[model samples]
Each structure stands twice: as structure tokens, then as C-alpha cells.
Target: MPPSTVNRQWLLERRPVGAVAAEDFRFNEADIPVPTDGEVLVRSLYFGYDASQRIWLTDDGGYMEPIRIGEPMRTMGIGQVVASRDPGYQVGDLVEGFLSWQDYVLARGDGPMPLRVLPPADHPLSWHLGVFGVGGLTAYFGITDGLQVKPGDTVVVSAATGATGSLAVQIAKALGAKRVIGTAGGEEKCRWVVEKTGCDVAIDYKTDNLDARLRELCPDGVDAYFDNVGGDMLDTMLLHMNPLGRVLICGAMSSGYCDVKMQGPSNYMRICTYQLTVRGILLFFYRDRLAEGAAQLGEWVREGRLHVEEHVVEGFEHAPALLPTMFTGKQPGKLILKVADPD
Candidate 1:
């Protein structure tokens, strides 16, 4: 079959106020981009919609520059090299990297070192978004560096059933966390966290009294906290930290979309008194150490020492709906959008 002449993509209509509305983004089509000299045309297979990118949209100047108004929205996607003008990539070779939210991506060979294509491991394709991809890498680094939880140390993760948190739970257990405590929004998510990750304690914030439950679970006080959702959960956990405890602040989804001012934790002052260490983490900021993380996580997955959670949405048009699910805290695991071949 012949390749299509047009490419479809989602473009920003306006900067979002709070929660993004359907009208905030527009679907547009362009002539399928031709690969210039030293470039490759990639047909996107899967697109990632994560909380980190959403945070980028909300504010300017994080690590990378913000997506300018009226431009194609940015995301991380995996695709196959369909046509190449560069010797490095051949037709049908798979690659993953920062991409526009579109069905076809033109990767500049001269652009920042393109992520090398690798043989798909024993896991499902969606694993690239969940356990084996950036989500997994965050979990891997948080446990190893940010928290430095030892084999017998008790570890707790907030947003416990989401993409990164779910994997963190499993990784902690794999590394021998004596007690793995997970805090999720509801009974269903909490139960899944416990069952899937074999966590020692799972708290459903929707029903459980967080302070009371956490105190009971970690009678010795928590050794490490891998926090994804911040706000009150952080406040509650701070009060329960053991002396010299470590905290990794990975996300603050609870405060991300609010129009009003977010509340700060009064208990945060306890950090000095308890000798607590808190580090706010942006996974991409540690891209220099990505190889170290991928090596450890990949080995674990290959040996069946880790499990991946994935939710695959077919078709590129479904990209906009993916983010709101994360905002509402409704999506299960990592969310990926599947696109058809370019031809």
C-alpha cells in the first residue's frame, strides 16, 4: 500500500486555565513530512500522555522550553522508522523519543542523540510506557537514589496504584523492602496495588483514616516515602516519618490543576528536628543516569523480578482524553495511544 500524503496532529488552541477543555486542543492535518537529508520519517506506534508533560503545559521554563502557543503539543512516543535519509536508521527500525502528539514524526538525524532502538523484550509493547520505559525508570531511580531504602527498611509510596507508584511498590519489594506500604484513592486501586505488587500494607484514602491507618501499619515509623501525589498526603506522612527518614517528591497531581492556592505542610518543619531529607525529583533532570536505571530495571524485567502495568488506547485521536484521566486519577497504570502505520 502507498503511504498516506497527510499527517494528523493535535495542536494547542490556548493555554489551559485549570483542567483542559476539549476545545483547548484542535486536531489538524498537514502534508506528511518528507525526510530531509540526514533525517528519518517515523510512523508513530504508541504515544505517551503523562502527568509530567501536563505540568510542562501549565507553566513555562521547567527543564525544557514550554510548548509555544499554536504549536503541536509535545509528548514522548515510540515509533518505527518508515523512511530514512540517514545511514543510522533503516526502514522498519523502531525508535523512541520526544515526539509531537501525531501519527507521523520526522526525527532529525542531526537532532539530539536519538534514543537507540532495541529489540522488544519479553514484555508487551505497552511495557515501553509502563514498567520498562520512563515510568519504570522513575520508580527505579526513586528507590535506589532518592530514598535509598535498604533491604530491611520499610518503604511507602503515595499515588500507589498509578503508573510510577505501582512500579515503585514492586521495585521496592524486589529490592527487599521489609514492609511496602501503598496509599491509593479507593478500595479497588488499593486492592490492586496489594494484589499486583504484594505490598505489605495498602491504604485507600477514600475510606481509610490516613493518619490512623499509616501509624498502625508502620508502628516503627516509615523509613522512606516515595511521594507522587503531594498536598495533605505529604503532610500526613511527614508526621509519621522515623528519624533520618528520606522522601522523594516525584509529583504533586493533587495540587497541579487547582485554581486556588495550594496548602503547604506545617509538619514540613519537622524535617530539621527529625533529620529528614526531602528531594523533589524531575525524572528527565536525571537523564544523564538513565543508562544506569535502564540497566537495573531491564535486568529485573527480563528475570521476571518486576511486572508492568499498561493501558493501551488505540488510535492517535485519543491523545487528548488520556491526560484528563490522570488529572482525575482515573486511569490505570501507564496510558499509551496506538497509531496506524504511515503507509
Candidate 2:
């Protein structure tokens, strides 16, 4: 058992109107919760920062249930099982799943994304939340299944310096893509995308003329597009796609996730004219194949075909502050907060 009897928590004070701020969450202490039937008590170690957390704060909560006021902020986290009423989880087992912003969390294994019992591995435990977790698994399935990237195909990935995009760039290369193009906000991030993720060309979307760069880089037209920053970027990419090309609508970071009601792309008519295959990816749909995706990602990592980058902040107090940076400029790769070390 932990030395402290109180559970340290960051609870939602109220939903934000536009941009999320640190003031929106209130830090409090309460008695540690006890697990009942089929539930496990978890001691959190790491918390992953995702843009979707902002969507959860909305009235509709996008796909999942909305997080209520006064409740602990929801997050994807790694924790140690301290106590268990469920047969699937045992005390001392490490798990990765939906954990809240608290020192201790009561988790069940039957959710859409189950509380996975992490196996012993040579990689860092936090990697399960990044490359081997949602970000990596999503990129793997999104490229392999959603976009159906093939050898000799020209691929473009928006938000290339991000957690999922960074991996998606390299995964496209690993699968023998003829050329991989990445788009970032600035020259530094664009350069980093090419240097770190092996992107054939990096477009500075903030400064560069996206249409001209796409025309020059992908003369034959983009065969596959991994859309992370939707809105105008999606609209522009649609006009450059080859006929029968594949597009994956993975995220819309440009909207800031402040509201779920976003404007659709103006050039969506191109989808019909080009006969493009546009699809959206939700990790919940591939829950059963998570391990299979992880295995492939692990193999790529070991073979030096994939690169893992993380921007990790320490301490529970910094959680709220780090969240706002997800929409703003954050460093390349997965954004994580280290709360505690497992026993």
C-alpha cells in the first residue's frame, strides 16, 4: 500500500468555453477509493496527454461519455495494480488503459478499451502509452488498414512531428512507400520531421504554399494521405490526391478540439470526382487487434525501422498546464507526464 492515506486528484472545476486553461481544473485531496466486485485499484505512474481529452470536456464527449464536473479528469495512463477484485488483474501487475488524473484509480477490465495487463518487455513501460500504446497502435492500423499504404506509393502525413504522425511517416517508409511527405508548422519542425522520421520531404504548412509544395513533391499526386490536422489542410489535400487514392481522417488538431462541431472540407466534392477512399480511425474499433498491432510496431522498433520520441513532464501538479500545450506548440512526439514510479 502507498504511504499516504489520501488520494491526490485533479478534478474538473468547469468546462472551458474556448481554449482550455489550467484554471479549469481544481486540485483536491480525498480518501483513497476501494475497489468492489470486478474492479481493480490502480496506483498511477504515467499520464498521456491527448487532444481528445479536450473533446471529453465537451457536453457530448464525442464518442465516449462526457466527463462530469467535480469528477477527476479522464486520461490514458499507466499504473500498477495495488488491489484487485477482478480475476483478470492481480496485485503487482502493471496495466495500461483509461485512468483518471489522480494518485489512485478504480478501473474495470470490460470497457471498450480494456485494462491491458502489460507483459514483460525490454522497452520502457511508458512506451506502452506512446509508440506501443494508442499513438503507435493507431498509426500502425491507420496506415496498414485504413489508408492501405502500398509499396511505391507517395504518402503525405499532416502534423508529422506529432506522436502519431511521426510514427506514421516512418511506418509508411517501412512498408516501402516510394516517397513520404510530412507537414509541420515551422521550418524547425519540418526539418525535424525529415531528419527524425525519414520523411522524403517536409512542408512548412505555416509558411509554405501547401498547394505548390504538394504539386512539386508529389508530381504524380499523393497516393495516400494521413490527415491529422483537418479543416483547410484536408480540403487542400483532397484536391491533390490521385484518383482512387486512400485518405485516413485520423484527427483534427486545427479545430483545437474546443468544440466537436467543426466545418467540413470545402473540396469534399473531389472525393467523388477522384474516387478517393476516405476513412476515419477509432482505436476502439481495433481493440481486439491491439496486441497484433503492437507486435508489428515492436518488431519495427527492434529492426530500427521506427523511431520513438517523447516529451515527458514530471509531477502531477503540471498535468493541467501541459494539456493546453497539446493544441499550442509542443515538442515532437508523444507528450507525457510522469507522476510516480512503480514499486
Which candidate number maximizes TM-score? 2
Compared with the true structure, the alpha-carbon lDDT of candidate 1 equals 0.79
lDDT of 1 by residue, 1-343 (tens): 2236778888988878777665778989887888989888888778877776765565563456777777788887777888899898889877777778776778865444355564656656656666767788888888888888789999999888888898899889988889999988887887888887778879987889989998788889999999988888899999999999999988877787433345778888889899999987767666678777877888887888776777777867678877677777665588887776433
On residues 48-91, what C-alpha lDDT tens digit does candidate 2 reach at each position? 99999999999999988999999999999999999999999999
- Colliding residue pairs in candidate 1: none
Give the Cα error of residue 199 in candidate 2, in Å.
0.3
Error in Å for residue 108 of model 2 = 0.3
Q: What do the candidate models score in CA lDDT, each in turn? A: 0.79, 0.94
Q: What is the lDDT, from 0 to 100, of the residue 281 in candidate 2? A: 99
Cα deviation in Å at residue 260, candidate 1?
A: 12
How many angstroms is residue 328 displaced in model 1 relative to the true structure, after the best TM-score fit? 1.4
For each of the candidates, give the backbone clash count.
0, 0
Displacement of residue 216 (Cα, Å) in model 1 is 1.2
| Candidate 1, number of clashes | 0
Clash pairs detected, candidate 2? none
What lDDT is reached at residue 325 by model 2? Answer: 93
